[model samples]
Target: MPYSYEPHYFEDLDVGQTFESAGRTVTETDFAMHSMFTGDWTELHTNKEYSEDGPFGARIAQGPMTFILSTGLFQRTGIVERTVVAFLGMNYMDIPNPVFIGDTVSADFEVTEKRDLDSRDDAGLVVIDSEMTNQDGESVFAGDMKFLFKLKSDAE
Candidate 1:
């Protein structure tokens, strides 16, 4: 049967459609947990004294953590939950601003492109322009992500 609720099938999304996910504070706990999980205990992300003397003037969240949080925020939006078949890849990933503890960040996304898949008629590709921004509107991370989404007919 077709999906009973609204879910973004491949054909349901349109280029230029934009969405912003809810904001979440990046706490010290979040930073620490991410560090432990990834074994990325870089001074910029973990050592306050070291970072205080460094470029950002204080410790900052890990880039990968920031990216993960941004994606999680967007996932919480529930727009593509069950409809997405796979994450194809990412391009042009960049971190232009530091994300510090206590900073509130939100995920923003825009549908930039959509195309059919010749090998698999049941799915299509969707290219999304994604970003994470702090409360001050400085971008924390930005990238273009490609997703394979099941066609509407497959929802049944």
Candidate 2:
């Protein structure tokens, strides 16, 4: 069934409520593409033989790759389908664990703050505490992201 994208009001997102998104598996090509794009040929990610000597004992995806995958997973969450105005920026981004090829990744989010944009009557701002976890359910990345979106008509 086709789903109608409901416009979520800024005030409707409760502070403790959680939102999750679909997961994705990292692949060899993903590593290659990222390496090629950034010219990051660090053996830990691009050289299988060299990586074998590392803790993972195999070529692991670059930490930034996990960060990128996390963004894709975050987008799959329908939260952005609502009254999103714009993505402002991110803060405290960190990767605490190594993400390897074939490992799946997903995103979890909690609304941290919401405030009215005094100058813009139609929208407000929201800050979400976001975390990206690997298939093992370990938090690999975390940060806060800010967005601008339409305000709820009934919001105080």
Local distance difference test, per candidate? 0.85, 0.77
Q: Which residue window of length 10 is worst by lDDT in model 1? A: 1-10
lDDT tens string, model 2, 86-123?
88888668888888888888888788888887788887
How many collisions between residues are there in candidate 1?
Answer: 0
Query: What TM-score quantifies how close candidate 1 is to the native fold?
Result: 0.92
Model 1 C-alpha lDDT per residue in residues 16-116, reported as the tens digit of each score? 98877878888889988998999999888899999999988999887788778877876776777888889888977999988999999888888899999
| Candidate 2: stretches off by over 4 Å | 1-11, 152-156
Clashes of 2: 0
Q: How does each model score on TM-score?
A: 0.92, 0.80
* CA lDDT for candidate 1: 0.85
Best by TM-score: 1
lDDT of 2 at 83: 66
